[model samples]
Target chain A: MKTPTIRDVAQRAKVSLKTVSRVINNEPSVRANTRERVQRAIETLGYLPDLSARSLRSATSYALGVVYDNPNAYYVISVQNGVLSACREQGFGLQIHPCDSSSPRLAEELRDLVRRSRLAGLVVAPPMSERMELVRYLAANKIPFVRILSAAEDPADGYPCVYVDDRDAAYEITEHLIQLGHQRIGFLWGGVSHRSSPERFKGYESALKDYGIPLDKKLVIPGDYSFDDGFRGARRLFALRDRPTAIFGSNDEIAAGVLAAAKSCGIDVPYELSIAGFEDSPFSKQSWPALTTAKQNTEEIARHAALRLIAELRPPGDAIAAAYAKNEGFSPQLVIRDSTARARLPAAD
Target chain B: MKTPTIRDVAQRAKVSLKTVSRVINNEPSVRANTRERVQRAIETLGYLPDLSARSLRSATSYALGVVYDNPNAYYVISVQNGVLSACREQGFGLQIHPCDSSSPRLAEELRDLVRRSRLAGLVVAPPMSERMELVRYLAANKIPFVRILSAAEDPADGYPCVYVDDRDAAYEITEHLIQLGHQRIGFLWGGVSHRSSPERFKGYESALKDYGIPLDKKLVIPGDYSFDDGFRGARRLFALRDRPTAIFGSNDEIAAGVLAAAKSCGIDVPYELSIAGFEDSPFSKQSWPALTTAKQNTEEIARHAALRLIAELRPPGDAIAAAYAKNEGFSPQLVIRDSTARARLPAAD
Candidate 1:
C-alpha cells in the first residue's frame, strides 16, 4: 500500500544507496552479481525509479544530443542511426538537433538546447565540431561532449573526439590513380569551410610529391562539395588544351557531377578518363559504371562519438568509461569499381 | 528572488490563465495582441515556465514522436526535417523513433516509449501507418496521433490522417507511356505490405483497361521497393520474346535499376525502350539520362501530418485545431525527363 523509495530497495538488497542508483541508471560500473540482486529486490518491492528526479539529483539527464549541420541526407541519417545504436545499448535517449553552422547565434541556441532539455552530453558533428569557437563555448559551460572530426592526428585540446583521417584516404585514392599511370590528375575541392577540404588537399599534394608529379594550378579547381561544382570543375578541366587523364572529386556528389559532365562532353569513362570520388555514398554505387571511391564509415565514427560522450557521463574510474574516453581514429579504405583503369598511351611519331 | 507563477503573469497581462498557457505553448489560436501582452508580462517578471510540472498537470508533454520503419535514408531525413520544422514553429520538441514493424513486441515497445517519454502525440509514417492493428491499439489507448498514408480517399476512421493519392500518380505515368505510342508496357511492384504498391498497381491496371490494352500477367513482375528488384524485373522483361517498349517502376530506386539493366543488356533507352518510376528521388535525377517519374512531396506531407498531430493535442474548440483536423490529400505530379520517349516505328512496316 506504500510507495517504495530507492532507499528501501537498497536496504532490501543489502547494498549501498549509490549501488542501487547505479543499477537503476544501468551504469556499467555495477557488478553483475550486485545488479541482479538489486533487480530482484526492486521486483519484490515493486519499486519504480523516478527518472526525472534521479536526473535532477545527478545534475544530468539520461539523454544525448546529436548536433549536425549537414545537407547530405544520407550522411545525416547514417549519423543518426549510429548514435541511436549507441543510445539503445547504453539505455540513454537521443535528441537530434540540426543547426545552421554559419549562424552567429549558434552558441546561444546550443546552450539553450542543453539547458532546456537537461541533456547529459552532446555528440557534435562537423563543420560545427571543427569550429573552435563553438567547442570552446561548450567547454566553458562545462557541457560534457564528444566531437566527430576530420584530422590527420588528435588536436590534443584535452577533449575526447573521434577523428577521421581524410588526408590518408585522399592519399590512397591519389596513389591508386598514379599507379594506373595517370599523370594529370585533377582535384575538385569541397566547401572551404569544412576541415575535410584542406585535409584531403594535403593528401593529394603529398601523393603527387611522392610520385614525382608536378602539381598544376589549372588542374586544381576550387568549389563547394556539390554535383554542380563537380560539373563545372570538370568542364573547366576538359576545356584545357591538354585535359587531365583523371579527376578526383572531394566527395561523391562532386564526383557524380564530374561523371555527368563527362557524358555531356561525349567522353568515355576509364577508356578516355578515370574518375575517383570520396565517401562511398549511395549515388556512388548507383552511378553509371559505378564509382571508385573511399568507403568512409561515417556510421561507425558517429557511434564511437556517442559512446564516448555517454561514457563521460558515467562515474569516473570505471574501466569501460576509461576505454571510451581514449581518442579514436578512422581511415577510409579504397573501393575500386568500373570508374578507373590504366591511362591510354599517346600515338608515336 | 521570488519566482513568478503562470497565475501572476496571467493576472498582470489581464488575460485568462488559459490564454497565458496557450502563449507559452506557442499555439497559433492565441491572438497576436494577447500573446504580446503575455510575453511582455513574463519578460518583465523574469518568469520561467516550469515545463515538466506543466506536462504533469496537462497529461501531455510538449513533444511529438515520429514513428517510422523505412529503410530509405532520403525519405527518413525528409520526414524528420518536416516534423522538426513544425515543432520549432509551435515551440514543441521532436523525438524520432524508428521501430521494427515486423517485431512481435512492436506494440509493447511503442507503448513503453509513449509512457516513458510522455509524448503529446505521434506522426506515423508507412507501412506502419497502414497497419490497422497498430492504429486500433493507439486509438484504444486514447493516444492523439496522425498517420501519413497512401490512399485515394479518407478512411474516416475518426482519427486524423494525411494521405497521398498514389493511384492517380501511377495512372498518369502509365498514360504518358501509352500516349508515347507504346502498346506494351511492363510494371514492377513495390513491397506488397505497403499500401502504395496496390494503389499504384490499380492505377497501372486502370490505364491499360481504358486504353483498350489487354492485361499481360507475364509483364507484371512482383518485387519490393528496391534497385535490385528493378534490375531483376527489367532483366526478366528483356528476356521476353516480345519485350515491352516501356517499363514503370513502383519507385525511383527501382527505375534506376531498370536504367542500369538496360545498360547491362546493351539496350538503347527511349530509342529501343522507355522507363518510368514513382517518387522522383535524388537517384532519379542522378541516374544517367535522368528518369521520368512522379514527384511526391514527402516533406510537405510529413509537415502536414505533424501539424495535424500537434493540433489534436491542443485544447478542443480552438479554431486552428479545427482547421488542422480536416483530412488533407496530395497527388504526385508527373515529371517528364530523358528516360521516356515515343516507341520507334517498326522498320519496313
Candidate 2:
C-alpha cells in the first residue's frame, strides 16, 4: 500500500491543503472544530507529515536524548518513564542512551551522538553527571544538557543540574538509628565512583560524631551497590567477634542482601540484628518484615531534569520554560518500617 | 560555536565535496583511507550531516520505536537494551514508548505516533502484541512491525512475531516437581490478559494428567504476576487444612513472594514444602534459597524481534535481511536451584 500523504488528509477532511497544514503545524489560525476534523482524518488515513519539511521550517529537532550509565534496572526504568512523560506532554520524542561511563572516548561518543541525532538537548544521569570534566567538555562544546547528580549544593560552575542531597538523607537515616539506641552501626558503601557514596559516608560520620559515639573503622565496608556486595559485606560484619547492632546498606538492594544474609545465619532481623536500606523500591516493601529506608523520588527527579533541559531549549520568557528554569534539589525522607528497632543491651557480662 | 557543515569535514579531510558525500553515505566507491580520514575529521569537528536531506534522498527514516506495557522493570530494561543494541549496529535511532494496552484508543494512539514520528518500524511487546485487533490494524495500514509474545506455536497469521514457548517450559517445571514425588501441588497464575498464564496453566495440567494425579481445583489460585499476589496466594494455601507439599509460582516475582511467605509461616522450604519459580530473574538468585526456574533469554528474544523488524525494512535480497527472515521461537530451559527438592513422604497419620 502506498503511504498516506498530507494531501490525502486534506482531501479526507474536506479541507484545503493549507488548512490541513495549519492544523499539522499547530497554528492558532485554524478553528477548533476544523482542527479536530483534520486530526481525525489524519488518524483515519494514517497520514505521515513530512518530518524533513517540518524540521527545516522550524529549524529545530523535536527530540531529546537521555544518557546514563547505571546498573540498577529499577532506577533506569524510572528515569526513562519520567523522561517519557515529559516528552509526551511537550510533544517531543525521547531517545534513551545507556553507555559505559568508564569509556575513554565517552565525550567523543556523546558528541557524535548529539551531532548525528540532531537532538535539541540531553538529560545526563549519574555517575556521568558527577564528572566535572565531562560536564565541562559538554559545556565547552555548547551541547545543551541537564545533569542529575548527587550533591549537597550546586557546584556553581554555571552548568544547569537537578541535584539530590544524599548526605543529608544519609545523615537523617543515621540519626534515626542513633535515636533507636544503635551506637555501634555498620555502613555498607555504594559504588565509589558515584559521589553519593562519599556524601552518604560523611553523613554517617557526622551523625556518629554528634552522638559522641566513636566511629569504628572496622564497621565501614567498601562495596558497590548490589545484592551480592551487601550479602558479602554483611557476612564479613557477622563474622566479627563484636558485631555492630545495626547494619546500614547504602541502597535497598544491599539492604535486601543483608536481610538474606542475616536469615541464613539464623539471626532474627529487628530482634537480634537491625538492617536498614536506602531507596524505597518495590521489593523493599515486599521483603519479609519490610525495609526501613529513605524514599528517594527518582522518577520525579528525572522528570525535573528533562524539564529543565527542555526549558533551556525553549525561548526565554516562555511560561513553562520560565517555570522550569530554576534548578531543582531533592532530599530523600526516611521511611520507618519494621527493619529497625531499639538495640538490645549486651547480655549480662 | 558554529555548527560544522559537511564542507568543513571535506576541507579538513582534504577531500572534494563528492568524496565526503560518498563517505557519509557509506558508498562502496569511497576508498578505505579516504573514509577513515573523512570520519575522523567529521568526529573532530563534530559535524552533523543533514539528516532531513539524507532521509529525503533515500526515502527512509533512520529511527524505530519499541512499544511495551509491562510492569516488570527488569523485563522492560532488557527489551530496551536489546533493541538499543540492534539499533546501534544498524545505525538507527530508537524511541522507547511505554503505553497502556488497556486504553480504548490504543490503535488510534499508535497510528498517530507512527505517522507523527515517521518511524521506519516498531517492535511491539506483549500484552499489546497479544491483541489481534491492534495487530491487524497495523497490518492493514501497512505499518511495519514485529511482535514478541508467548505461545505454544506460532499463530501463523502471516504477521511476523517472535514467540516464547511458555507451555513447554511450564510443562518441564511441573514434571520436575512430579518426579520429586509431589502429588498435591499448588499453582499461581500470572496476569489473565497475558497468554502465558493460560499456556503455563495448560502445561501444568498436562503434566499432572500424565503423572496420573487428579487436578485439585482448590489448589490453583488465580492471581496476577506480582509479589503481593504471590504472598497473598501462599498465605491462603497455608491456611488450608490440606496444604500442598509443592508450589509453582508463575514467575520469579511470585516465587520470591512465596519464599517470603514461607519464612513468615515458619515452613521449611524443600523440606516440609518445595517451591519453584519461572523466569530466572536476578532476584531469584538473591532469594534466600536460590529458586529453580526456567531461564528465558528475554534480551536475546527481544534482539531477534528488532533484527527481524530491521530486516523487513531493508531492501529485499539483502544478506543481513535474509539471515533474519525466518521467524524465531524460544523454549525457556529449566534451571535447577535450591528451591526444589524431593518431597519427603507425608508423616504416617
Show the lowest summed lDDT stretch of 10 residues, model 1 chain B.
B50-59
List the candidate 2 regions with Cα displacement exceeding 4 Å.
A1-52, B7-19, B28-48
- In model 1, which residue pairs have backbone atoms overlapping below 3 Å? none
Colliding residue pairs in candidate 2: none
TM-score of each: 0.90, 0.94
Cα lDDT of candidate 2 equals 0.89
> Which candidate has the highest lDDT of all?
2
Task: Give iRMSD, candidate 1.
Answer: 3.2
* Model 1: per-residue Cα lDDT over B220-287, one tens digit each: 99999988998999999999998999999999988988988997798888788899998888877766
> What overall lDDT, based on C-alpha atoms, would model 1 receive against the true structure?
0.88
